[model samples]
Target: MKRSLSLPGIAYGGDYNPEQWPEEVWAEDVRLMREAGVTLVSVGIFSWALLEPSEGVYDFSRMDRILDLLHANGIAADLATPTAAPPAWFFRAHPEALPVDRDGRTLSYGSRQTFCPSSPAYREAALRIARELARRYADHPAVVMWHVHNEYGCHNAECHCDTSAEAFRAWLRDRYTTLDALNEAWGTTFWSQRYHDWDEILPPRATGAVPNPTHRLDWRRFCSDALLALYTAERDVLREAAPLTPATTNFMVMHNFDALDYWRWAPELDIVSNDHYLRSTDPESEIDLALSADLVRSLAGGPWLLMEHSTGAVNWQPVNRAKRPGELRRNALAHVARGADGIAYFQWRAARAGAEQWHSAMLPHAGTDSQIWRDVVRLGADLKALSQVRGSAGTAEVAVVWDWNARWALELPSQPSEEVRYLDTVRSWYEPLWRSGVAVDFVRPDADLSAYRLVLAPALYLVDDAGAANLTGFAERGGTLVVGFHSGMVDENCHVRLGGYPGAFRAALGVRTDELFPLLPGETLGLTGEVPAGASATLWSERLRFEGAEVIAAYADGPLTGVPAVTRHGWGAGTAWYLATQPDAVTLAALLDRIRTEAGVEPVLDGIPEGVETARRRGQDADYLFLIDHGGRGAELRVPSGATELLTGERIEDGVLTLPPGEVAVVRHPR
Candidate 1:
């Protein structure tokens, strides 16, 4: 069930809003698209108001002309349903369709995604528009994929209104089946909050004290399902109209934005596509992009599409820094190396006005003679040369387990530390592998770990019995397991497991912690022994008593000095290592290097220095390795002498690859 466009080479180009400009501008857009080598363009994403002016009146003349023009120019269309934003008239007429925030304030319709997902009026109107668009573009020559509703849960993931409350109650009924079961799962006996009837439950609102953690967690899950239900209602209509056209919706799968469990959403999407934007201020933003791409690939179970990214300077960030001379090309190639079959930007041409007016584009407001334009043309040509790598997937020896449910649980109020974020801790573990040039895959806790030599779970705060058994079985079956601090303390309902910290994995991890001593801001703990000197634990630490596990590293000085800061337990054929504190970068790198050696996990490319990354895509006929040097400092790499270099078409008998800052090389070798 792999999904891709029929066109040749990596699909390029981005969102094209012909409705925003006059008909005269459409031709120039096509001509520039041809010059830029654009093979695909997503159209009509936010043109809901323009498409349908009134209740039953829709104007398709402009859309038809746009599709025809794109087809004439040899470009395919990922036609959008245009239901992301309801028309102002529709929202005004059906005011019940508006969403209410947690504080019980109705969200106005000026911004997009303001409709309630569970509102009957909104769903009906959205479906009507979707069906009309699907029927119109079903067999159109320009249409290749049906993009149903732009990024779900972007703004209105939760709505605390009567309609949503009814829908959430129904969703809970379907899950729990009865009130008794719901009470037991929620542990509602505490605080005299047990619900006698389904209607008594409510969405977690901002209260003087913390709301019930179970209720908040379930509400987040319900909101995700409600949005998914809306997506499916429109997707089914599209499938019925255009049975052959693949259906997808761009997902915003960034850190701290896991309201929707994409693992559940993946099966519904024919091609898992994602919208990724870099934090311009973060020096390691490239690492976040790679992690996001890897996650999207895992969700798709194969190659996915980079549906939306900025060429430079996105408007929403505090500091919208422009990309350097070669950074745009470097960024796109990074996604391609991570298994993105298509590289696309948010818009083909810069918007003259609106919220994203300052957002950079392929053809910026400076017209076709800009550095951005040149970079776009060069990337198109480079993608054409590297087309053979399409449909190939990157393989990894390490798997990092992620649970959106746990993330939801962690974000609830009243945690020990304000700095303990699920994604940040996960990235802390991933940085070591990334710096070592080892490719890693993100997986669910229940995913099969047989294919991986090492599995790392960093802040899995919520773990069910099955999750615990899975990790135990993996370690017992000869795979090294690394568990981070503040993990395994709660069950599915966010209830404490009671016996000790890290409740379920206590036996498997062979350690017990009686106290959690979270460090205050600007606080640090000294570490000594086998660990690196001057290395200190920051953010968090635990007082531990090892059970058959050896103390690898102990705190040199702190409230919990001489306690085991790190422990290793041999369970059957493998070992389980626990890090009771957030170690410094140097300590983490050393610990990961030791584990990588013990597990026999090797890097994709050896001797690759910092700022140089490598990813391999295995095809049936040959294997291609993509090496990217993000840093300006040059590095030399050894490669197959007789391999074909795709970028330069140079088949050298003695190739010694050298990359000088911001250079990318794709080498193809015979299988």
Candidate 2:
């Protein structure tokens, strides 16, 4: 069934914890929120202590009043199950719920998510609380969604206790089935670490030295599965009472919680939700956030929620930098441009005490008249005015392939170059198209590539026969293919494919690599053709030999000097480009520009300066243009001459629309 939300216009507002404040402040908060046009409020986060002050005792009186007030004030609610942290009374009664660290020390509740996921006592207690919450409030028309646990994963390298050890063994047995199979998979014969029994297998821990990388990798996979099992158990219980309500858990972008596979977790979720934070100064931050957004959209194959974002600066990082004047508004627009169905900040009210006390909030304890509060209010008004244009936005024509199994297979390799990071390579390919205002959809490896004119696969280190066939088929049918180094070397099982490098893709790419020149850090290599400045040639550079391809650029210097750095292979009516070295941003951008022209790909907007992003989504009766100003200086954007700015009701038929820093314009052209 297709899922949809009731709240209109990019569900605005954020995490609101009014329970901590006195009732006297309720009226003021409601006024401030309504003034900002804030429509949705996420309540009950981090409220386990308030909800269950004592074991076997439940209290929702405070939460009830908060929700009632929000609903009465015309605000929708996304109620969270306050199960992120258990109450101290429950922990004291059931000490077994504590998670043990890798060094075998049991953890105490100094922070949230301290409970062990595999603990039976913890699961039972958490389910009881979730069931109670759903039963009591499932019928509330104001409640739109159920937020399970807040960011469900371990924060540190822990959970190596006895319970985890037992769970690890069970997880392995289900995966490998036999001791010999496990031994072979992990290559346990090396270092005389062959396991004689399933009992011998232990979870990865700091206490013991990791002599085998394969074993450590497997343990990571096992740990992720264990947590997924816990999440699934909780979700099942919630579905029993509120079967109609969508259940979701917030995810941190590119977070590696023992390699928890989000692709595997997507189907179980009603809508993918994530927290994206990027400063305004960073050039690639917006693109990075877009990658994460595309990743979630591809995982769910639909629109997702922007669960949490810093309204300004975050207090956690070593550098606490606030968003400059118009930065917050720009970031919000960027989210909508990338297919976000809802936008919510991390916090509503600033914390008066605790670790997050210094973090920025919509309404600081200093009150709602502050500069940050006013900015949020203005942005909220813009969002409310644009709500009528909801679901009438940009659509992506190009799809970038994102495969979880391939990502896992690449990372699992025991000897792959450490410099070939997955996320970094993916970003390298994505940023060029993003800056060029290309609407990109992150598609799974199995998705149909025919819809896209260009398909890019960066550091696709693992390629099964089926995936290889898909790529080859796409190219054979006149689709342009762009691939990067270290790709097509291994299979799904992390085993090297024989015959040659890029085993299954040798014929499709029209190239074969005989040797790889592993370049050390600070190594310099020049390209024969025009190259981008500041591009690092680090990591292992492959010395290539083309079978039926022409070299576009060769290394200008080095031992493999004058060898192929980039090659183009003609396959049927289309062509494929194999990049053997990481080029600088300028060179990469130029290369992408050339490819776009050759493939007849049209940009949504042309000649936009750096920090400005543009995207277009068209429906049967309307065309929506999402213009975001990422630049620090306000600039005039040349809208398509006759479009009208939907947010401000301004006509752009004869002149350019001037957008301030971090400002967004949603222009609609009625058909």
Candidate 3:
């Protein structure tokens, strides 16, 4: 009884909210589902109010009919625990369960995810509902997977209420048994914030000034763990009731979500799934999608599912821009190309009323006659044609270190420059690699880098002892490593590493910087030597005394003009390069190009037109080369001798395939 037994090739369909519609519409839902080739539907995700009208009174009658209809129509179910949204009755009884904001305002129950993660009443009631749900339908034939608690920590990542304070104390006690250890770790002597008693410490509510960085850091960690505890409690109940079915919670791994350290959370789940939507503000949101997909695939170490996306516009942004025609197909295929086994949207049908009423879905409000609906049907067929690539894995020869701990430390209230955004710096390095057609995988700093030929650490401002050693060892063991500005400045405690800049990696990089001279607003500087022509720098520069390293580039005109802006060192059998300042796009791309050649890393395909996205996922029998013309350029590439393009059924014997602008091709060749 394997969990994969029920998967219909690449599982299709999205969140099916039968609870939102009447019974009569459910019949139409099933008919349309079959017509669209849907194989699965996530049921009852936010149905606690419908299922549990009153305390100790359970109703499974409605859910029974929904599951029956779905099963009768040959659609599998990703059954949910319904713990994300606690019933209004439960909140009315235990009003203290509502989360309190940092400004001491109690969040009302009108919005979703109103319950505090640390509330005992919430934990008990959520577990009970999960237990009851499992008892009723765990053995049902339609239940293929158990989805426990939707999007944990999406809204209330932290709470400052009394119950949370108590739980925080308990968590801290477990982390640091004594008051002295807690004081030492948090560095409380700076502003007379040392704790003599464990209960004396409280959540950093709104104060006159910024709170301790270490305190904020630890609280972030505790918040992630608190929600994780809720997920595990429900997951255990579902696991006991249904031993064969796997359980997962959709992760928000896109640019905006940084609350949860997914590395700590990914190992606890049976599958790694993520919900990603287009950041409509960015013109090239597809690159953001690629970054998120690669991160999820790396977390799973193989294939994963695209839990939720949008067919068109999302309702949340200030100006929700709709996806243009053909953008939908390209987005879905890009996820699959990066290693998504299945593609799904936020919901199956558009909501006529609700907070997210305007969010797009599989079946738009305009019905099947619309372009969105047609694209959905076409994408479903294309996924079925890609059934052979379900377990296939991406071939990422390069790795980039992306850690939440460092990110949290970097974004603290006080820093060199407020403009040195964390995600922006990471993306600056990743974009060039994507443009070059190379596959990239995001990794934790201490993860085994032996597999990759090149590793990039952009704006990795924080590093602990183990992480520092792992990075330095990779460079010493013949793996080329690149570190960006402001990295290795502090230890895990947010305490500066004392003597020089980049304390943790100074020895490995063979460069020493006494201080940092971050640029002012609207400032820019030029660089010369071993870099692309007209290479400019911005945001940051440092007093680099690169005595032991070779100066690859130097500031041509700035405050620290003529200083070593970029340096390289041959440490042991490998190489370590450091960029003292953030270089412009062309310079960074040229730098990566030189590094790739030196490290012997190759892109998925070479000599392709610019703006075309490329990725190769290798199955046991064949390698699928995904060529997506995201750049809107007609292009040609040399294909394998007898490769066949899956999308159009075109055979290639002359070893060349030409693609028109906005076209997509999946070329299959021997693995």
Q: Which of 2 and 3 is the better model by TM-score?
A: 3
- Cα deviation of 80, candidate 2, in Å: 0.6
For residue 249, what is the lDDT in candidate 2? 82
Model 3 residue 657 CA deviation (Å) reads 1.3
Give all candidates' CA lDDT scores.
0.88, 0.77, 0.90
User: What TM-score goes with each of the models?
Assistant: 0.99, 0.93, 0.99
Cα lDDT tens digits, model 3, 69-178, are 89999999999888888888998999999999999999999777998999999999999999999999988999999888888888989899989998999999999898
RMSD (CA, Å), candidate 3 to true, equals 1.2
Q: Residue by residue across 206-294, what tens digits does model 1's lDDT show?
A: 67777888999999899888989988889899989877788889999884577798888989988889999888767888888888888
* Candidate achieving higher lDDT, 1 or 2: 1
Q: Write the per-residue lDDT of candidate 2 for residues 327-372, one digit (tens) a residue.
A: 7777777777667778889798898888888888888666766788
Clash count, one per candidate: 0, 5, 0
Model 3 worst lDDT run, 10 consecutive residues: 1-10
Q: Per-prediction RMSD in angstroms?
A: 1.1, 2.6, 1.2
By TM-score, how accurate is candidate 1?
Answer: 0.99
Question: Largest lDDT belongs to which candidate?
Answer: 3
